[model samples]
Target: MVKNAYVHIPFCKSKCKYCSFVSYPQLELTKQYLEALQEEIKYFYKNEPLKTLYIGGGTPSVLEVSELADIIENFRFDKAAEITVELNPETLTKDYFKGLKSIGVNRISLGCQTFDDEILKSIGRRHNSEQVKNSVELAFSAGFENINLDFIYGLPSQTIEGFAEDLKTAAYLDVKHISLYGLKIEDGCFFYKNPPEKLPDSDTQADMYLKAIEILTGKGFEHYEVSNFAKPGFESRHNLNYWDNNSYYGFGIAAHGYVDGVRYSNYQDFDTYFKFPHVHFLTHRVTLKEQLEEEIFLGFRECKGINVQKINEKFSIDFEKKYSQILAKYTASNHIQKTPQGYKLSDEGILVSNVILADFL
Candidate 1:
């Protein structure tokens, strides 16, 4: 049964230089896009109660409070479902946050990529550090108690000391969730052609990560996932669906979904997607072998790693018989370990997780 849903709104006030996500600056499409989105959800939503709902992308809060309310009212959500909306700091208004809360949104994810003013300008984000502080206060003023603040590290000219200060300030911000992402020079992004200078070297970036981890965990945040930290019970339920390998419905250009062991994505090009305004999507199915491989990869991203028994039960495979050879190799190397009830990565395994995960794939 489908339990999670993601809606991508491909409109942003201004696109970031480092982002390669499917988003545009054409704000005029707001009305028609919302209508088209509503039609698509009406067609494929199954009207089933949902466990989680996430409104992401270009910048979900770019819409007016009324528009966001209209978009949310169209869905059939489960009681006490974890409903979330990603907000850019500049677009966060008190009325907007309250409107979202009134429509059952319980979580707000603010894309505060960094707290440094110079870095914010360099990244082309119009919002500054004070804007983030004010926006978060607006959310709390709207009675939003569950808030997530996202940040990035390893930026051009970033120092471990600077990021440490950010961490300390963030811990003092009274937020319950934090997501830390490393900057990557992605294709199609401006950074790919004009890469930033003085980006932390690989070794320095690793040290920055270690330092941030030390600070955050000390402030009582649990490092639940590789790049995410949360106070008790504040983990992102929408993302947990992916790590748990559960089914979710994704809508909008470039959005991807996994249903019934099949994975599919809507066309990436907005112009191409606009042609099929009302269609939920065209999709391709993933194989059982693919599922097993993905489970190993995404599962071990969590600190707990994989649950061998659970994998066996879901995919109907004997954990040992299926990969006795693979297991022997990694187990001997101490990359994987066997527990009383399951298998998981050792501490060293998590560090080189991609290497081990790629082998399984």
Candidate 2:
């Protein structure tokens, strides 16, 4: 069953320097874009009540609550479905928060990349540190208990101490969840064209990540996923669905979806998407070999790790025979800890997870 869905709103108030997502600052295109999105949803949605729904952005909060409601009304959610929306601090208001609850949005993922005023401007984020604090307070006032704050480490001019301070501040706020990311200069982002000076080196970034794990775990948050920390029962169900390789529907321009072992993406261009929003521009049928690789890579991302027995039985292959050499190397290095269930990345392993995960592929 396709019990998870992702709705992409490809409009932002302004583009952030590090963002390469398909988003535009033109408000005039919103109406037409939304109409096309509705058409796509109607044509593609399988009508199963969703167990989790995530409305991600450009900036979903840039739209008025009424407009957001129009989008939400199209879906049939399970009785206890988790519905989340990505919010920008400067875009929220008390009324908007209340309206969000009315439309069944129970989770708010605020993009508060960092708590430094100068860094905020440097990254092209419209909100300042004060706005971020105020936004969280306002969300709480509006009865939002399941709130998530996003933080980025290794940013230009960011030090290990500075990133640690950000983690402490997020913990003090008492949010239910947090997501920490390392800055990458992806092609087409501003940093890719004109790289930022004083960005932390890989070793420094590793230290920053370790510090975050220490701080957040001390604050009673569980490191549920590689980049996500959450209080008990507050883990992101929609995201877990992805890690579990469950099928889902993705609607809107540049959105990607995986359903029944085939991955597909919508056209990125506005004109192309608007012309035939129901048609996917890219589609790839995942092979059994690729599926095994994904199952390992994605499952290993969780703190609990992958179930070796389950993987072996599901894929009809002996896990040990297939990857004994890979296992021996990492296990000998203490990068992977063998658990009763399976293998999970050790603290040392997580610091250089990309290198290890790439080797698995």
Candidate 3:
């Protein structure tokens, strides 16, 4: 029924060094871009009364409250809908949070990469640690109960201790959710061209990730997903929709969607996107084999891991027999462990997840 949707706001005041996402520092095109987005939504959106709508971007906070409200008004949401907006600390204010609340936004995900002021500058982030704290306070004051703080573990000049402190501070702020990611200097980011010094090694990053799990869980957060931890009832429903392999609509430049077993993405280039806003840049109908692989890959991302019974029934294959060798190898190594429902990756397994998941592909 496509009860979930993701809208991309491609404009940012400036680019972050480690970000390679399809975003631009072109606020001048905001009006035109929004118009194009509306056109696309009008053409494709079926108004299914979305259960979750996530507005993500180069920086969605760059837009005015009224503008963001206008975008929200276009969608028909369920009564209990989870509408999330990704914001930068520097661009938020108490009034801004109130405006978002008035327009039906129930969740706010703040980009607080680190608490170290020096590391913040090295990564080209516009806000500092204090701003992050202030923004969280303002959000809470504005009556937002579901707040998420994002942190990167392996940034330039970032240390394990510093990252642990960042997670602790987030917990102290009483946010509902936290997402941690290892830094990947992908192509198209500034770091790709001019690599920063003092970057942590892979092993260090792994340690930082484990440390985060320890700190957050100790604070009564559930490590529900590999990269996400949340208070009991505060997991991100929009993102959970993705990990569950459900269908959704994607709007705006570079946004990807999976609908009716077909995965599609919009154009990344501004010129191309504006010209063909209603047309998808690429579409691939998922094959059964690919779908099975995806189910395994995505399911394993969760802390609960894959349900072998469901997989066997859905695909009509013997889960153990088909991948007996792989399962035995990982199980013997204690990297993959069996659960009442099925199996999940151990902490060490997650460290080498790429290598493990690749074998399934």
Candidate 4:
């Protein structure tokens, strides 16, 4: 059964330069959007008592507390379920957080990006460094214990020292989790049309990633996933659902979900979504070969790597014999290390992970 659900809120105050996610600045349409969203959820949701529910979007914080609570009331959750909301630092207040807690929000993922004020402005982020600090304080004061700060490395004009300082500042805040990402100027973003100056090179970005691992690990955070670190018992259970290749339900325009071996995505345009709120724009039934490939690709993303016995039993194949050549190649180069359970990427291996994982595909 699908035990996780994700709801997308598409309203944002403004678009960020480096963000290509499907979010709109038309706050005027929020009421209509929420109405349509409720309709979609009513038609599709089976009320399975979700284990995790993530409310993400262009800016979910832009909605009123009553509106957000209305959305949450539609679902049934397990007693220990994790409910996370993504918020921007600028839009948060102590009362806002308290209201969120009252409605059962247990985790907050703030889009901190960086503590460098100039860099934040360059990236078209609305919140400043001071706001982020204040927001964290407010969240804590509001009784939130599970908080995550997101940071981006390799930003334009961001030096290694500057990035290190950003991570250190986040760690010092005593948040429970941190997520690090390398900047990517993808199409549909302002940076794609007008590239920023002094962007760090690929090699430099790799260095920043390694440095983050060293610093965060030293600060008592576990590198549980490729891009996420957390204090013990504070890992993101919602995201862990995704990395585990489990099935989930996705509601709202531009959201994607995988369920019962079929992956589906909703329409990206508001008009299309409103007209056919219950219809999926695209759906693909994953084949056995593709599932095996995904099992390997997604499993390797975790620090524990793939469980050989589990894979063998799940796929009814001899794990090592099937990919002996690829295994031997990387193991010889020390890129992949042999673990008691299976194999995992070494520090060097993670740097060229794309190249290695592609070979498996």
Instruction: Give the Cα error of residue 202 in candidate 3, in Å.
Output: 0.9
Off by over 4 Å in 2: none
Reference-based lDDT, residue 188, model 3: 92
lDDT of 3 by residue, 5-76 (tens): 999999889999999998999899999999999999999998789999999998999999999998999999
222 Cα displacement, candidate 3 (Å)? 0.5
Model 2, span 1-361: residue lDDT tens: 7898999998888889998888899888999999999999999987889999999989998888888899888999899999999999986789889999888899999999999899889989999988889889989999999999999999989988888998888889889999999888798888899888888998898899999999999999999999999999999999999998778889998899998889999999899999999899999999998999999999989989989999999899999888898889999999998999989999899887788889888
lDDT of 1: 0.83
Point out where model 4 deviates above 4 Å.
none
Error of 2 at 120 (Å): 0.7
Give candidate 1 misplaced runs (Cα > 4 Å).
280-282, 324-340, 346-348
Q: Write the per-residue lDDT of candidate 4 for residues 1-361, one digit (tens) a residue.
A: 9999999999889999999999999999999999999999999898899999999998899999899999999999999999999999897889999999999999999999999999999999999999999999999999999999999999999999999999999999999999999999999999999999999999999999999999999999999988999999999999888888889999999999998899999999999998999999999999989889998998888887888998999999998999999999999999888999998888888889899999999
Looking at candidate 1, the ten consecutive residues that score lowest on lDDT are 272-281
Model 3 off-target regions past 4 Å?
none
Deviation in angstroms for 226 in model 2? 0.6
Candidate order (TM-score) = 4, 3, 2, 1
At residue 198, what lDDT does model 1 achieve?
Answer: 84
Clashes of each: 0, 0, 0, 0
Model 1, position 85, has a per-residue lDDT of 90
What are the RMSDs of all candidates, in order? Answer: 1.9, 1.0, 0.8, 0.8
Q: All candidates' lDDT scores? A: 0.83, 0.91, 0.93, 0.94
